[model samples]
Target: MSAPKIKCPTCTRVIEYSDQYPHRPFCSERCKLIDLGEWASEKHKIEGNSIYDDLLSDDLEQPD
Candidate 1:
């Protein structure tokens, strides 16, 4: 009998199922935690210019 192999999402490393991988998708626990922390801190954000920034002009002056 043989186990299946999987790829690590962080480094794209080929890992064997029998390696007792605690982190399934990642090759190591460190990589897994790094990815987890990224999500926790809201680091994964949508790429694009902010609409609010465009709507608000810095050059606009208020009447005294």
Candidate 2:
């Protein structure tokens, strides 16, 4: 059977999904790091209302 393939999340490069590709979905360490940087800078986020927003807003409305 042929190895499964996937596109790297950062560079969109096609790569084999196997032990040979240690980074798996990332293609390489550089691509993985770039993705990490994006997350750290808040460039990537899930589309949804965050549960923390309600908790924090409730705290702010109450007197400490």
Query: Where in model 2 is the C-alpha error above 4 Å?
Result: 56-64
Clashing pairs in 1: none
Q: Candidate 2, 40: how far from true, in Å?
A: 0.6
- Tens digit per residue, CA lDDT, model 1, 2-56: 7788888778898877758877868899889888888889887778868887668
Which residue pairs collide, candidate 2? none
Q: Which 10-residue window of candidate 1 scores lowest in summed lDDT?
A: 54-63
Q: Model 2, range 1-64, lDDT digits (tens) per residue?
A: 9898899988899998999999878899999999999999999998987888877775566765
Give candidate 2's error at residue 54 in angstroms: 2.1
Local distance difference test values of all predictions, in order: 0.80, 0.89
Error of 2 at 23 (Å): 0.7
Residue 15 lDDT, candidate 1, scale 0-100: 89
